[model samples]
Target: MQLNFFPLNFQFTDYQITDVNYSDELLLDLRRRYNTSHSFFRFGENIYLSNSDSDSGIDIATNTTSKNVYGDNQITASLIKHIFFRTFKKRFISYTPVDFYPFRFFSSKEKDDLLFDLLPNQLKGRIGYKKMIEVQLRLATIAGKQQFGFVINIARNWIFEKNCATLNLEGYNLLNVEVLHSEIYPGSCGILAPNEEFIGIISEIINDETAKVLTNEGEQVFPLTELFIRKTKFNIANYLDFALSPDKTSQILNHIESKKQEIYNTKSLHTEICEIAKALFSSKLDGHSIEFMNKDGFYFTVQDKPLEVTNTFDLKTPTFIFDPAGTKTNNNNPDLGLSNFGPYDSISFDIKSPSVLCICHRENRGYFSKFLADLKDGIPSSRYFIKGFQKKYELTEVNFQINELSAFTLAEYIRVMKEWDQEFRPDLAIIEIPNEFRKLKDADNPYYQLKGKLLSYEIPVQYVLTERIKTYNEYILNSICLQLYAKLGGTPWVLPANRSVDREIIIGIGHSWIRKNQFKGADQSKIVGITTFLSSDGQYLLGDKVKDVAFENYFEELLNSLKSSFNRLESEQGWQEGDTVRLIFHIFKPVKNTEFDVISRFVKDITKYRIKFAFVTISKSHPHLLFDPNQPGVNGKGAYIPNRATNVFLDSETCIVQMLGVKDLKTAKQAMSTPIQIKIRTPQGNYNNPELNDMLYYDLAYIVQQIFSFTYLSWRSFLPAELPATMLYSNLISKLLSKMRNVNGWDADRLNYSLKRKKWFL
Candidate 1:
């Protein structure tokens, strides 16, 4: 291989090989004659040495005599040495003397480029060109290796302005040794090197010798072509080279393009959805007036009253009014709403288009503010196309009677909204609702106390509740409308989407602390500890699954795109065996999705074929009946209970013992002490059907693949399915589901419907 070497910074000083050595005796004699202390030698006013003996000036003799070795013709090697010595002495004397004290090199600030600032008055000027070159050499060599990544190259016209320096780095590659050398000098040349040869030598050595060694066979490795060089106040650092593969680079470009498209798509969708929503909720009114529908009314204060009714001479200007008669408005903000349509104003003249706006409520705690700050810092400014502005208003919370809310109170709320419209005339309004509404309405729940108080006002208002309701999508949309109506007085334009409630619940299970240590044998190892935590249980449960599935499909598409982009051919048709993935299944209690029930039954229906299976139950307060069954007694009935003589202890092996239907610390301890052959302890405890085990696994694989799209992603940190657990689980599930789908006598949808109709969820 042809290796190219480039020493990054070798130009400042030249390296020379020498055979001559000065004798210690000679130096000692010279010191004494000069009357200089042996520790401090001085040749003249400015020339001095740290190791010299005398302070007096001293000079070495240039006289030389020949020495015969073979006695053939006299060879004058001594003469040649004398000539070199004499010449060096003359050159040294001719140049101005400058003392380079040891402090210049040994000083604490020697590494600092600003060391000159810390110099002693007398020693400052003594430190001149020679000392500077020495410092520069040392710094360059040290920084070269440390700062070898993140290279920057400047265009010819690039100019950098810094304190005490202005660098016009024309056509400068930060990695170039010459450029670095130039940066060390004073004045214009400080940014450009005087010794090009020295720089060239450094470049050669860095490119081949040092960098090559580091790259091919060293503890550190770096990319050669992409060698990085960075500059700072102190010094320049260099990194060896690395280059991105063409395919990877192309993939990144594609990803960027996809991101741009996604942003565009989201904005477009928001606009369309907003338009549709606004059209549905708008109502027409007389000139310069508009009406909107609302379930919960929001409160606002008008700072100024509009002009009284008067016939104006100029008929062209549009007139806006808040309330013809003085009226009171509502206090608390509500979100319940519905779609309505209305004319912009009663006048025949067309109203100007309302500006669509989006508002997010101010979080009481600073958590959201901090999150936004982090987002602002982390996300590139270019990524956020919209400029987000926010403002907050403080108002007293008021409660109106239910009758007041429906009629006069409602009118007052509308009036306040109109007043707000006169000022900002906002097209849309956004509001936040309490997230804990379930407890309030149930049995004098403390949570709903506020809602009840507001309802007593009897106002026809818009409101959004913070409840985990089933199919709550419609509620969310209406709440958005309500906020708009409450704020705009005259409806501007706005839309909202419904929220989904079928609230999901997740359960986590673990063994109790006391039982964990005492029950399991001390000598027995705890290698596999099973703990189950609920992923999600609600109407929108597994909603993330859709995204995952899309990502999976996207990955496949990406691969295909890669092949086409690079024009590569696939060797096989259809999906190869290795391409298929296995899935793990987890179901939270109180599943509301009818489709999932159908899937559960399908697992049972295909149980004729023997299949391995596992199951667990999770609960915090009560032991599960299905999994934590009572252990057998001496009479084959039940074991002795801790509190009641007639009651038996529950079996720990049962899935029911697990909290949240997943293995946790508590259940793990129980399993350790329990007998291994206790078949009843296994998860599928309810059904000893071996065929169903395989079918269950098969179905799980299908579900995960269908949900996530790709089989490549792996699941980590599970109790079982060792080595490649999630993959294996997914594979098995897929196989089972495929078989069920093809079963001879079953209808796919019918099977699904059965699971929903029959609550087989335990």
Candidate 2:
């Protein structure tokens, strides 16, 4: 058979995860309703709207789109408070137990030095400042996190004016004067009298003529025309007004940025890695005969034939299994749910051993856990929990009230719940992360606490996924497949009990990329070690998974990290004194030159230890698609047509290894994308080590077999994912780090030490 070899020359760089350019869906809807022409919209530097859209687009969070009408008519900080702060009073009074401040705005003083001193001298003389009102606002607690902010009220208006105008009354001990006041409005409140005076900080601006003011007599609403104010220097040192400073927003985004970066780096790194690999065909290496060892001294390998890889595993094949009642219905709408389909023939696997499930959930944590526990061997055929949670138990969306949470959030919660009932303590604690948890912007996020609390339990914690209260459909036989896999410890990915690979030591590496929270408008990134690491024996090492932000931009720091990882792994896993160790790095993206340099330095340093490693990348993101040479196209299951073990050498640098392929299927909509590209790189190749190059094997079938097995061992998902352990590890660790960083802040010292060799993050 003829082989095609492709040359490698790809552009690679530091992949930065940026904010999602969210199209203004609200604006789009508004435009659709009003039938606004596209040409009517004109974007300017400081506006999300055009001149014609006056006062229409006000984003309270940043006030970035706020602007005065023509003639430079602007209001002072005090005036802004009376007019706008009253609209957001409820937010300040009883702050929600959430991290994002969607309603906070920039204070007027921040944008203009004139702190509510907007009245001209002539106007101030007309309405002399005499009465003063002092408002005391008790700070609100955010999910128990104390926060400070202030509001200033100076001018009041009586009408909504296209050219709203106002002359500020003279102030006392404090401020300077700037910005004209216009865009006056008249409503239920009477017009302000030119002679009205002494009505200090307006607590609420009600209509045009009415407003509540905080005087020595306490809060009372008076006619706006009767209100007046003087100069006051309010000590607003630590208030997090959006315009005053970006510190609060920065803090929020910074927590999520790490998480986002970890994801981006993992994907991009995988891409960069696979394309750069060079094939090192070792003539003596056997591709079919596999032999591997486990810690138990047992050996394993592929038997007579490999099992078929289908979209749904055997446990999930419902083609033959049907509803006992043979019920009929309209098109299968998931929203209508599976209830109408009648009694579904239960799909059960031989657990062989009795097992208990511990569902670590949030929100109605205990209730949710109990719900899953009640399901014993069955999944909900209907979407019951989501529809009537509030109705049945008064459960609201946000769970700021920890006591009312009825779920496991803190270690105390776990203890309390378990002690309350023996049923709460299961044999395996599955931290089935709730999807909503990822939307959080703080340290209180449940993902940050999953590890430190659960691993201490007497039983095993086999991490797995369940469908959301809605369908959490990552795969068809999700819950069952995961359950069986957890119980049996063998999948299609596992080799026969009698066979094993020939390698003595196998190393797997994964990468993580995270970014600041995009919603917080802070987008910094870091490559972290909170990634995956595995051995050939399908085992995880604690030290290897000891995650930290990878030192980037500096080769020296990366060098230290490399040394640190190997040292940690060697110490924890008990390295063999003389056995040959194979290091395999699985990256989803390509590598940058600088990153290559770091790897080069690492390889050179490791030579002192005489370790043989292959820095390889396996990517599924490229444009390249592999198909069968004989029969190409769709399969009966709607999966693509490809031979079960098709191997294509696109070039000397790349090979497409089809691990679990099918040729034809008509039962599904889309065919499975089975081919994965593998590329290998050597630090010595860049170093000109001819001897090192000779020792490595470049067999496509061999590597493919290892990768296929790796996919089956994922601790997270039910089915074998497209990703392997090396890349998968980083995804898990980076994700935990990202979430934990939000709650724990930047102090990872605890994580480094307390969880140095613990699988707590899982």
Candidate 3:
């Protein structure tokens, strides 16, 4: 049959050339669905991919064989399978049945769907990838023998709660399950398990006597008797929002709502947030000089990071983060924590300082191929600034690319890294990606997929952006500092030791809200506060719980909550009963003096123990914006901003801290970052010993330093903390409990006793 290729724009009798890449139309088709520009390229065999950045950039890959792919997050496994069919158009290439996503990644829900045979190339040699990839293996001397167990989501699993599979799972079981068939409580209408995480409209009453419930855990099938219905239909505007259906059970919901209504009484909490605009710079605390650091300096800790006050919290050694699934070898014994290192800070970052780079990337935007093409045996472009870094830090350089997933999902990142660790252990892992991908950390892209999966396990990781590595010469030199920190790891380069009289403990409270089945067809929500107590040295000891109570009352509720928190530290940490203690409470937002009136007429009674209470609110969101546009000694590029650890005290008790950098904000691409406002108020707060000079005893600098130091401690990010440990740990725990509220049961006493020492929240 004779065929003619006509122009795309030309009119045809009935047929149309819809897709330019597949159709061999002579002219272009501009008047398609989207009104956007397009780029067409032809490799061998006229290979073409649609290029439209406005259409959310595309990813394309081609192997020497028939394996090929091109799409914007849409190229499924079936789509890639067609490449073989197209390559061997004259004959059939398939010999066995094929089905599966090309990526090694799978959601917790997709466990049943995946075929074991046609998995990602990285998993071929590994005996079991799922357990390793999905779990982080940590060793502990339970009795005496070293037992290997998974850290689960923290270090090993990148995906954590970030499962993108919209596919329905069978049940909400085992996924953040809190109470497992523990109680049978009476419901408003039907006797129920009030805490059934998934409350959905009965889609179908199956003949199997099961009810279909669409929950946040995805669609689930529950036995019909397991389902609970409100006495009346309370319509929900958004179904995906898994709120307690109106009129399920009010044991949790009604009480919280009643408290909030009684607490607020007014329309809002407060109209005016007192801003201490006039403030003096606090330079010292208790006669000790305070220092500020831009970023966490990779110090020679264990030895370099001299311990001022010896504490039991152990610092982990230098570690790597990457998915080892596709790698040909398994790291049977991944070097985790400081087990083998000598007395000094030996096992920390300076892990045999002639440092090595474990390069592991998904689709590297061809940087991997380009770097290799330029230097067959020498350093790739990704390590362009390596020489400068080496000269700067005096270290050796070796590249070890841990093969795994790219264009990876959260679960995939975690699972692959877990599995890969079985074969390979790295001092530092590199997952080079584009800057755009790093920013889209929304629910869609989930930036934590890369950092969270590795960092939580204390695995040192570096995300080398394609923008930074594409042109080795143009890589930001200042960025080398952190890399040096990672390569030559140890304890953080902290400020000089403070006096032993540093008597202070902080309580961080994170607020998370959940739904409770309410009476009279009311689906109301209650805000719960999760708290963690940190000793003076930023050691997280015990976590406390305050159910749905804000900063109201004679502050008795908060003080009462701290009684157990205080007792635990005293008994476990040897803090005595009569010793004077400085209690600092770190909350999320700014509060008025009304919230800080602890010593006011409202409270006639005080604790027997000597206590000085301070209320400091750390604003995660504030209106304050700061800039060091033309600071001398720093970069003069109009874009340059103050380095991390910048502070501006508005008053003795109020300050603004630039915990992170300008690079972390939305304006990160366009402008410098804004600082967080720290508002403080002390009502009859006095921690001074009679001998100390008031002028030299200035506490603001020390308080500010404490806040800044906690930022670096969060394994959540390599960046300095935006929130302190008390708040950071609290925030994490609150989020975990809130997210898995269906399973999160709260017994304040139980949590302090059981979970205080665990990192289960992370």
Candidate 4:
């Protein structure tokens, strides 16, 4: 009636064969196995024993199955029924049906085999199964050993990259992509700090020039204090280097490369460059002065006065001197003709009255900042001195702007002077060309293009102290020496200055070469001869080093520098000089590929053409400034009247003459061209209305004789356009008059024709 189940020892022990209903040991063992396999479930209470034939019995059919479907259906139906058993097994069973109760209870061993059918299929039982799952609970327990090991690995890599690699990049928020403070370094005390700009201190041990002395006594020691005091030389070679971490350096390099094309394509930093340049020009040049202001102070001045001249050609401004020989005049007369032109005299204002008023241009700020900082450090004082201009001349303060990209912003600067100095009508104006002009083209212009832009006003301007050089030469010392004399106007003997024949001329050629070289290269000191050029037509050329002797030198330096600096750069990724050249030049050679001769030719053609068509208005009178084709150097030289000659004959009869000393028809015509010629009336020359013949003869002859004396000079060959009407080479009219024959009034071609009166000789 009572059944006890226990674990059975399956291997036979020799004992009487009495089969009990249950053994406690066997039941415990079976129960333990069941709990191990299904620990996720627990029974509510003890369940009643069931007879083998009870309703909870197993269906005996096996290979000959009856009620269930087969395949997936049969498996699924079987699973549903097993699930119910699992549910029912959880509750206590107090009774069973009498039909099943009338039978003996199955032994524990027998029941184990029978209950195998109710057991969950192994594959299905494991599906969708979960045990315990609060993750943090295990982390706090000793059982979570594996998870703790994982977190440590992540921390190590973060620390390594941050400290060892010196990577500038910091951890970022992966979700929002927000930048984190990881870019900053954390201090020892766990304090966060911003990125630092470097304060580098270089310590170098100097090798003593003098050997140390050892005293014979060996006790005496000479302290290092008296050893030697060679100066310490430490310059921040590249300021950007201080803060440049490897990552940051790489980043910047990448950025630069990516933007190379864009940067070169852009004309200027901003449009302000052009606007600033235009703003410097004066609307009117009635008064010739300009104003300038800077942080240092403010000042102004009238432009240089016009040079006085005895002849019309004396009015000529600076230009490439062509005449080999002529009477030289006072050097102070800027227009006095001198073929041996060099940077002999560059006008400089007394420091006290420095023409360079204020440094108002924005681009100048960088220079001023360094200047002011250096001044505090005793740097500027050692390099420069200041003095005042003479008090007699009045000055006008001017202000203006120029864009960074302008080539001829210099004109705008001059124009501004003209407008401001309108009152006294300053004869000379001074201006500061912006440093922006120093920019070398990325790719030099092709077709050797010559380009220039006009200022706001059409005021005439010239270059001062222009220099050019080529890639293969170096002539800096000479240039500095000349610049000193030309600009500072002081002896530069200390700089080892030596004068040579055609030095200026040679330097000028060199200067062009240097400019071309610079356009092609990168050295700064290859510049050569510096000079100015002008024409009688009021074309004033005043670029610094206009005829710079060292231009070739500078050009060469530029080319070399460009090659050295850019040769190694990869071509495909970013900007290079090649790109710049390609953009500007339809055809270009690589920096390393261009030959010196090729560059030189390009520069010559470009410079010549740039100034070739240059129309000038030297005088207000059209006749005085007319082009003379007959002159071999019409465009290059003879455009100006010859020195010492008041009358410049454009043609046999048409001429430009000085106001004073009119002589004959030619002299009279020349006088007509004077801007401020005085009208002279002679007793016989006036009859209420002076006849052209009378004015040309008596009046003109008397005036010339009185003013010019009896000085008869040899006649110079006239310009081609000034060819005489007659083939006679003689200056005498008698020879030409001999051809005329006396005739009767009715048949004479010499009979008075009213048309002769209307047609003046010209």
Candidate 5:
């Protein structure tokens, strides 16, 4: 297996650095004075300086000391990064730094005219004159070794193509615009600006011609026509509804293969950087120089083979149990399983005759009828819900439709839903809405308003886009019926779990940011926490405890909520004293050490039982990609895509798992799939710490296998999801809570009742 990493070979293990007494003010001044000739970075509590030239004539304080860059992984990594940044900036147009490594890189010359042709008519002349290909790089320790390498990928620089004012006039909300030209404080966006150099977000629109901008100098008025908006994904999406598609992905790959042929060949950039390193550090190293590892080029070949795991349904084969008795099962597929034996837990599902409310525009009545017909009676080569759900689960349908005019407003949607709730309480609702409704603000969006209003009445809603109905197929209905069944409190299948001596509980913590005014880009935004609990078998236990709080109070609230949940479950599940219990937390990307501290303290306090826990973070935003050069492509596309469940251990505590692969890609239009990186946080402190010991003894392989299996448990579709069910469910809850928080009188607590255990968010 080949990674996108290119290894760098150093001629000397130690390099000299000028150590200065670190003060924020002094360090800032030094950086400003020697911005081009030197690199200054902070490590731990101390600051160090590296010069591009041995005798650059730059001076620090008189008491400065010199040291060698040896020992300490963090310090060594920091030195390499600073030196690379100092060298790369002189050759390329670098953008704002993303984390420690400068990920975004652009060429001095235009790569192609692709963006020019793809730009909308209104944005053609408003864009920048130069178009470049953006190259992203990641530096990491590969193959569990201390050796460093750069992971590279290329994309079209759409960000540099257009300006902010062009998007603002094109109907974009200019509340949180990024500024590209600010020198004092770059990439700072919000209301608090300390000086004129710190001018940031547009706080308010004073008039059609003027706006109030918060800068360091104070709240100042600026001409709307003159304000330059930084081109970002948010602004572009809001203005043009742009998203990355297969065609765009293919175009990017093709361009890189042609124009930037050295990237794939791993030749041009590697040699050029080696020469730059030699010039920058040869004199500083006292006679040594740097170069690239020439063994089979710069790419690192992963020595460890990827481990492949398969999902099991009943502690046996990879199959689905279609009935409560476990007598009927199908190993073929989820759809075929349901068609052959019915849904799991069908015997106990009390809903005998389910009533569905169909809402659509009057002009879409024809499409609505056809959709309903396909649901009731299966389309060609598909099993109808009547045969599977109605026959096996005794769930006959009592359906009704309400078609409003095309000009219907949000108020009309509320009125109709309320009337329907009072007259005929529906067990479920299937609303057909136009695609444009997705572009509206959360408070004004009919989709959220209607869904929240119905959910308050204990009715789950499944929304279908009108465009989808026009291109409807049997497979679409299959996925829809699966979600509808699960939403109605029916279990399609459960992951196979071996009965073990220890009890295990998986908790997923997900959050969403709620802006004070979403459209106006208010700096004051609160975070809503969503927590989902699940058994080891991937069964969702209850409704999430959703809470909205200030950023500073989020972690405290999260800890308190976890304690409450554990207390309730101890009594409910009959957890006995001295029983071995394991608590595993699956969270999204966490930015602080507060989460580790919180979970560790919680585990230590539970004296009644022997507790073991794993705090795992699953992230997809990193610049890591896995490639299988020997694998065959799907119809001559995505040849390097690995298979699902293929995992490579980056180190003792980190592993990257591919959730979707070649088999998962149904069409050539799909973009190349990326894997999710899972890292288990090793407990801090000494080996004598019980928490540290427990974490160290836990098998990481078990955690990775369980995560892979849980991805198959998402009832939303038969295909495996990119995220495991724990994270997926929590994210769904967080998104819905954030969207409905703006709806007037929408009580999220209503979910604690009958809908608590159902898949309402599905």
Candidate 6:
């Protein structure tokens, strides 16, 4: 196994800077004077010149300062990054700083040639396109050794240009746009000026020439000519629908490969960096130079040769209990397991006479009737709802013509259903929606309106796309039935747990941002936090506590909800005094010290039981890639993909796990899969006290193995999910809650009452 990292060797660890009183204004002036000269750069509050020569007016100090370049020091990292930015300005046409290292690179091609030439004629002038390449120089400490490397990928950004205002001369109603500001400095790189911009969402079209724009500062009036519309993935997708032909797609891919080879290949990338390093060192920067550890004229390389210091955990295939007697079981596959032995709690499944209501266009009545019949009676060679689960359902039909599936029509239908038969509430609804509905705004979308109304009546729905009905097969039916069973409050299966003396609870924290208006992007978006609780066996306990609040208040609300849930669990589970309780939090991204501070304070307050906790972050966006030379490839071709479940320990508290492998790829054309990086936060501040540290001592191997097992517990599908059920469930809840908030009169609290224990989000 080979990593992308290379080691660096510095000739000297010391440098000198001018001793001057630090202020924002002085730092700005110094940057303007020397930034373009490739002589000085700003790091935090000080300006450090590259050389000790007295060319500038400022006096130089004789004293030398040192930075820990090998360790996790921010000053050293920032200095190296700044040097790279200044050097690369003369190479790339334009650059946008994403972080200290990662940058988006633009070419020097003509602006007219950069547009997406394959777009339809009608959309050609309305959308702007740019071909960008993302590159990052990563530095990290891996396996007790410091390393550095580069990762590169292609980025195709579809922008809405200022010409959109001219295209729609009548005036724009609701639009999301970005306004360019020339005065702002574009980070450390001085390649371009207009890249410094801010977002504005147009709410009301005042006239053909002006509009009311809402920004972070406040609502203001701006001329249409000054605003450039902002296009998101969702917005661009509405027009192209990702409908590129095979030839066009192949052409684009070939162009990407050619560009990558020109700059991002290992040989070319190393040469470019080495050239810059040579120039900088030759200039005698502060009378010192930094060099990389060279081996055969190449940077030092690291490989997973012995496979030492790495731990691999193989999780056992979970078994399903299909009968009350616990006599029948299967562990290989969920679909075959359930088909052979039925559901785990089939005997106690109370919805024996389930009912389904169908809604579709009147013209498609025959198509839906056949579709529902197959679902109820089981398609050929497919185990379905009735025979497989031993439950029959009554069917109800409702039809509407084209352009009739409106909010008014849905409300009237619900009213008529309630009036005709007081006891005619259906257990589930199967609605066939057109694809065009996806293009509408949330406030005007019939899909959201229908779902919100159905959920209010305590009815779960299964929406079937009209385009997919023709291509539905046994595999699709199998997956759909599994979800329907779970949504109807039935347990299909659970992961076999290794019983322990201590009780453990896993909590997953996920969030989504909600803009004030879906069409008009807002500067400040509210956050919706979703918290999910599960037992050690991966059985979801209840619906998440979804709260919508400002960003500043999210953590406080999360802490309160967690405390209340823990208190309830302590009493309900009959936990005794001095009993050990372990809480492991699996969050989506790395959080701040404040999160730990709040959690640590909460644990200190509990005296009845001894509590231990670990905060683990599982991220997939890091610039790390793992390649194995020994692994076999498809069709006897070379493939560097590692096997699933392969874990490499980066350090004591961090590891990378490959959840998908060659077999997981549906097609050979799929891009290489990247593994998720799992990191356990180290306790800091007061939490690092000797007594508390002892309580927080967690086995990193066990925590990772448990997470892998939980990935098999997502009831939505038979195949294992990329992420564990904890994070998956929380994310699903957050997204749904965020969208439903736009529905008029929709109450999130109602979920706690009616669908609290059911997997309705599945």
lDDT of 6 by residue, 167-276 (tens): 34733334544443223344444454344345566666777777776766677787666655555544443333334455654554455445543333223333333333
Backbone clash total for model 6 is 1
lDDT of 2 by residue, 394-436 (tens): 1122111112224534654456435535544443344455566
Once fitted onto the true fold, the runs of candidate 3 whose alpha carbons sit more than 4 angstroms away are 1-497, 500-502, 515-525, 548-560, 590-608, 631-640, 661-670, 683-698, 742-754
List the candidates' TM-scores in order.
0.17, 0.41, 0.36, 0.16, 0.76, 0.76
Give the distance in Å from residue 607's predicted Cα in candidate 3 to where it truly belongs.
Answer: 4.1
Instruction: Name every residue pair that clashes in candidate 6.
Output: 51-286
lDDT at 346, model 5: 65
Among all windows of 10 consecutive residues in model 2, the one with the lowest summed lDDT is 156-165
Candidate 5 lDDT over 1-762, as tens digits, reads: 555455555555554455666789977887777755666788767776666644544664633343332355466566666555544444333343333343443333333343445555655534422332222333343444555555554444444444345546556677756443332244222211211222467888776677787764557777665566555544444444333455654554454445533233222333333333344334445645333121111111211222222221111124566765557776647666776667677677777678887777788888888777767666556544445335534465536555554555776666566555566768888888888987899888888888887887788999999888888777687788888888988887766554674788888888777654422335544676777888886777765665777878877887787888888778889999999888888889563665676677777778999877888988897655666656766775556677777666665677788788888887654546788988887544333675557644355677887787778779998888999888999888887887788877788777765787789998
**Candidate 5: residue pairs that collide:** 164-229, 193-216, 194-216, 195-216, 195-217
Measured with C-alpha atoms, the lDDT of residue 456 in candidate 1 is 27
lDDT by candidate, in order shown: 0.22, 0.37, 0.38, 0.21, 0.63, 0.61
Regions more than 4 Å wrong, model 1: 1-430, 433-583, 588-600, 604-613, 623-688, 694-762
**Shift in Å, residue 234, candidate 5:** 9.3
Model 4 alpha-carbon miss at residue 614, Å: 34
Residue 532 alpha-carbon offset, candidate 5, angstroms: 0.8
